[model samples]
Target: MPRLVIVFDEFAEFKGRHPEESKRLIGIARQGRSLGVHLILATQNIEAAVDPEILQNSTFRICLRVGQAQDSLQMIGIPDAVNLARGRAYFRAQARQQFQGAYCGGPHGKRGESVSPRGIIWVRRDGARREINLPGWADGRGHGEPEPPQYTEAQAIVERIQQAARYLRIRRPALVWPDPLPPRLHLPEILARHFQGGWDGARWSVCRPLRAQARQIAEIQPLIGMCDDPARQQQVLLQLDPERGGHNLLMFGSAGTGKSTLLRTLVSAIAHTRSPDSAHIYVLDFGGSSALKPLESFPHVGAVVTRFEDERVVRLIRFIQDEVSRRDALLRREAVDNYRDLNARRAPSERLPAIFLIIDGFGEFKRLAPAELVRSVGALLGGGVAVGLHVIVSANLQADVPNAIFANIGLRLTFSQADQSEYFRIVGRPSEARLRQDIESPPPPGRGLLRGTPPLEFQAALPSRGDSDEEQATQLSLAAQAMSAAWKGPRPPKIRALPFLVTPTAMVEAAQSVAQTDRADLLVPLGLDFDTLTPLAVDLAEDGPGFLVAGTGPQSGKTTLLRTWVLGLGAQPSHDRLHFLFLDFHTRTLAAFRRLPHQNAYVGSAAGLDKALAALDEEVARRKAQLESMYEAADGDFDSGQVIRGWPHIMVVV
Candidate 1:
């Protein structure tokens, strides 16, 4: 459906160097007319370079100049080319004609000055002068003399064409061979290109309309990088739209191929375009913490976990799983098909931000994490996209990824692999011959091929304006700080970690407000729970018959637990309502609580234990007698319960 024109200059040299390609060109010249393909070849020695079949198939021929008449005759069946002046040629299609070709170079006067026919005289020793004439010494008025032009007509024509194109809002074609991508593409430059406003010295101020549109569009699609589309002869913005393209993205390449750099670029772009309320990012840096560590300062970044922090990693994974479930439930309740629909229907304040989970070193994670966690991650991928949970992972090799996870990935970006085999294995064989050649060539860092209908080669943008690692890190830090300063909205909810040490007063202050004051007496706050990070307590009235504090080794919090229980009860304002009998044998840990009003008895030795037990037995007997008399007073009706009033709750510790 499309027409292509192939031009070959100096056909003789081209044919001599590439015989196979010359033959293929001959074949195309014979049958390419029907395929909408045309060829134009230029050469001084047409008799030797022009194939017989190709000459027979050629419907048009043009001869500019030749050294011999034979070449002129062979080109147009006429010897007129040999005598033609510069820039003059003979054309032959159905008939022979003479014309002058347009000159694209500088003024012809500069070119003809060296060949001018002005006569010069050479003076001899005897003072006699001899005149000599240069070659082609005919008068300037001859029939086939060279002429000079005032200006370059070709340049004028090109300028006019460019002006017209600009007026019509048409882009010019890209160069056949573009220059290599620069080492650094600054974040500000990229942001300026994609966004529609300039920086006001402090922060970027995007146009209100454009900003609104970007926020709305960024909900489903976000720009990732700049793509060079050689086939289309243009550069375009690369965006990953889950609605149109794939939900998950996979990037694989050898080390130092800019996979990590590209990951950071994605986060920076999202931070600039979408607010913290609309999108959030969580990074799991299995490769190293340096790549994504700077992003933690961004308001949109909820957490950045490294490989060494196993507890944090597990917590991040669990958080993602819980978020997925929550969004899935929200979708079901609202009768929405996906996150986009829910966002469209819900109010802005109630909308859930999309979560992007970036895994830097997926291979190492798969190997180090437990299989159950790995499976949980795989399950998250299955339906995470529909609920606004997207996974962007990078690996060293395709084999390291599981098929289940790989199947969910829609968009794949591949950087320079170790070998051609590895490249083909990741993106499959490229359909274009030029693409094959390009991939075979060694590429620089950040150079990658994005797989699609026609695979696109792109240079990933760097966040820094400088090349060094420190400069890049500094740039990221500054960008994050700027974004944070510009944002005035509510920050993302942080994932809290349990405190290492908590105090009784802090626990009591953290206790939930209850209607009954005695409920506080029955509940003793110990520490915070892991899942909710809320106060964890023991219900004294409900959790019976008693409590046992056990540990694996000495100083494993057994004594600490008992002391906390004793102190927590003593610190409560209603301390007199509860009683305690301490039997601390090895450690006098509970001795500090001996002065409290709640202390019924404090026994520190084995002999004291007997006294404490006797005291407990006597109190129990008194309670039993009191209950028996109450039963008798109730006419032996045991169901009619009656008990002594003002009896305190007694707790024992050993």
Candidate 2:
């Protein structure tokens, strides 16, 4: 077996933190010499400070740059070692010897050829001596430019670093400089050559599962992913306050870039970190286009609003507003600044949980939602930070979101964008790091750029759909079962139904009993008024005057209005009292009224319309003649109010 030489730097400081490890090191020091193993320990003080065994087992002693005479005496058995100049040291195994160390070049004295204490001449392979030229003479040239100044080993390393930075600059690059460039960055010739092979190795590998990896490290904070910084090797934790970063998140990416997946990972991390009683998630996945459906089943979820519809969006916005107000009042009552403080002081039931609103995509929201929703979102973004309310929205592109909403976002994660301009919009600059041209062609899913003091490249985590086929099909199976089960049982009435939208059936049920009208009058109720939302009943006389109804389009409730009017009059008193006429010029407009007993005429085509009109004219003439006869019978007086008392009201609707 090959021998191993272990070198410990600053052993005294290391021993202070790890006493048990120090003891083990001493044991290894004592026995490793027999097993072809050795320890080369360096420290500002003697190893005895950590444990005396390390000092007793050491085979040789070297004293250099000693600050005290006693340390020099202990190591080299000399008193004059403290006064020694640079590049000079005393070595002792059995007999001590003093020597001047030669400078072998490079910042750390690791590279370049070793030289004797005194310079030596070199002999060529051809048996000739190679002599050094003086500064004044160069290649027998009178000009003597001196071969254009060669850089030292240290300078060459810096030049390589400078060039490496230029080549590694991404379109949207975040440059982080350690306050003092670390000694490791002072690369040797081999390491400097390695940087020439492109690929800075700065980006972190993807986190397969964020939970297990985080738990393995005993991480308690909300860790989204590991940082790409090879030097620091840190986990990118989300900062909930303004000090580290900001709470609100705004993510932008092109389609299929795993924006939704990243969102789920972040939300899952937060859920895993906080209890259900402390944090509640409200997911607004408009259109339900992703794997976010799984999060709905988590107990920490307060509500998962899916289906991209105007009413649903409106309802969610209103709910957020109500919740904000409720929390505000509770905070005031408890004399607390925010939900975190309130929870600390109030009872568990009274405490409010932190609300996380994660909106996956805003395309549907922008198109279908009203302006009020946008305003409400803006208010939440601006003021909800301290109140323990946070919003995380993912959009296909930054342009899809409103400026007001994006402005309040504290943290931003950007994946691949459509074009250069979009990338510029996301990173606030250009970047050569094209997701398409990534080493993992098409860039592995969930790869993104997170902005911070020094931006990071992150690979978001995707949770497993469990291990078995049963787990893989859970979402699909639940959805299929819900379809059949929805109508299988009656839903109990909600304790508090939304006031904005009342069911048509409920509206009809709530209307007062029809009022009995005079013999010649018609009382037909149209639906509730659009503006007032109050019952609207139109009064009409069957004798002469008529009403004309108009509507904008299909959803103008014209069909409902016609149905309500016809159905209302049919149910009151008797069909004989009020007759109805339906002219279905559009074929099916009046089709539903065909079976009503109150209908005197239901004309559809031109021929039917002509026949109905002729019948109506004849009826009017008959009524006039009957009225004249009755007036003549009442002594021919102009006061014919009592003449038509027995005549039936002819209601003609053509």
Candidate 3:
């Protein structure tokens, strides 16, 4: 099974809120290996705060981009996300890149740029950003047409973003920086020489000219069958056409085949460049890491909107739907209905920018989201072009990659993979990555597949350990010693048992409150509440790797019900109680949680939502353990102190 880099930047905080959804995601993730799915999430905040049942089998945590003391308390068990500036991002994959500013790019602003709270941007090996002034696209309106594209309130912000992209590039070099940065970019040999590389004793960085995939391994030989041939990596780059081909492509490969490196190079090369027009570059991140943070600085994205739940993704899709409508209106205003009409309206402030939306870990969003997977895929495959919304999806397995991604996608790429089935699944034919016989088994750190206009067939190797290293490290088995090493901070406190306190009345009350508030923090979620919601929280208290779903209906009171449980547990007061958190989906729930006292931390659709289910599983295990510790059978009142058997616990649902 190909190991996946599951980013749970806020799993510990939000897992309990949507227990059902979490469990469902985990179940799929657990079965992912056979199905080709990898699940990863952050657990620093809830390790001790939650019952063992919630995380029955989970025992790992990656801490990156920690907040302040309280925030760090949730990540790496050290409160880091707060201390770091906007640039920093952390990860459980210590083997990968963990710096900020290095990857996270600043936002596109009136002055220059600023860093975004979430999402990773790639760096340009070309050095500083170069501004370019280019002709703008018409806004789907004819010059003679009396009507014009609506500057509606919602579109106002988007228009501003469009304006910023144009303004930023006015004075820069055309390709002086970079273009086609989204949907899988590749840095040619000129860029990879910056960082230093080392394995065991051998290491190299970009400063040095990288020979054509140096024939042999130098310092590090971390993963087995890793290919380090710079030439082979370069050969793959040769196949890419950043300018054309699959705007939304897939690269399938086994671990150590250099897929990560290629991805890193792609991102880096994009950093130095800016899209000449709108619909340039945008990313809907499912993975909660800073790998793509650098994109924030690119001229493409006017603003970054980080979404953490399926609902948010859906909302974005809906927004896209609305945007398509807006464009249609623009066309009617100009008496033209196609790109040509929009071209006629192409003026400095008249046209809408082209957007290339890149989404990593396409499966994570589907794991627990209510949106139909096929429908979302169809939107991207069919209407995405009309709305100027392009997609680039990544998944550990070909199945997770989704049919829509491959069906309508014009381009395809595959990383090194021995499994021909996975390769064929992604590219429609036996994958070259799976059949790549000339390359070594382990194709270096960043070696993999990249398909574009020219079509690449080699691997990508960054001199210094690049983002690929971090991505590759995420695949290593958790059983490894390093997978769960204690952080550099104080020792993690012991976990305590938390009892369930949601009553039917509470569920109803929460639902009733939904009309007033989103019912964000209480258990029994404002909309969803049933026996399984409460009983299960208690049952999985002892580390059972459980995952829950809010069921089909809108998780109305679910967020509220979870808040109730969190508040109930937090009432006990202790670092142990502090361990659990409600990972906020991409919704206002986090804000609500923040306003309420006793919240361990608020994770609002900013991180780890793509794999929210994994976090739920960890909580389930804690619940399971607690339940098991109690009497052989059912125990009377399961509370914070009176353990049925003797264990820590907390209930979560959505």
User: What are the lDDT scores of the predictions, listed in order?
Assistant: 0.74, 0.58, 0.44
Stretches > 4 Å off in candidate 1: 1-6, 9-38, 42-52, 59-187, 197-220, 229-234, 431-441, 464-472, 496-517, 628-646
lDDT of 1 by residue, 1-654 (tens): 557788888888778767787898888767878889899888766766876677788889888888888888887998878899999988888888787786677543443343334455776544489996433333422223343322454543354445445545666664685665554466657767566643333554432223445335433255667777766667766777765565788999888788898888888777766777778899889886457887899989998888877777788888888889888898899898888888878798888888888899889999998888878878988779789888899998888788887777878888877665665666666544435455566666687888765667777877656768788888778878887887778776666566778775677676653223444676777777787777777877666548888899997888888777777777777766788888887778778877996647888888878878988999989888887777777754465222432566788877
Best by lDDT: 1
The list of candidate 3 runs beyond 4 A from truth reads 1-244, 255-271, 275-281, 288-290, 293-311, 335-341, 428-440, 450-456, 460-654
**How many clashes (backbone N, Cα, C below 3 Å) per candidate?**
0, 6, 204
The C-alpha TM-scores of every prediction are 0.76, 0.42, 0.34
For residue 468, give model 1's deviation from the true position in Å: 5.4
Ordering by TM-score: 1, 2, 3
| lDDT for residue 362 in candidate 2, whole number 0-100 | 81
For model 3, how does the per-residue alpha-carbon lDDT over 1-654 read when each residue is reduced to its tens digit?
A: 334545455664556555666667667766664665566664556453344443443444444554346555544454555655565665432333345434313333332222122222344433345543222323321233322244333453354345545545544222322221122322322333322331111221223224544443221111111122232332122322323453455555554454434443443333222122323455556555535544444333433334344444554555555666677677677776464347656774455654455565556656745556446656655664544444656656776655655666766656655665655455445334335443445443444444432333444434233245454333221211221231122221111122245465754554444332221222223223231222222213333347553645675566555565544444433324334455656556645545444424445674656565566677678776766676456567546446432333343333
Of 1 and 2, which scores higher on TM-score? 1
RMSD of model 1, in Å? 9.2
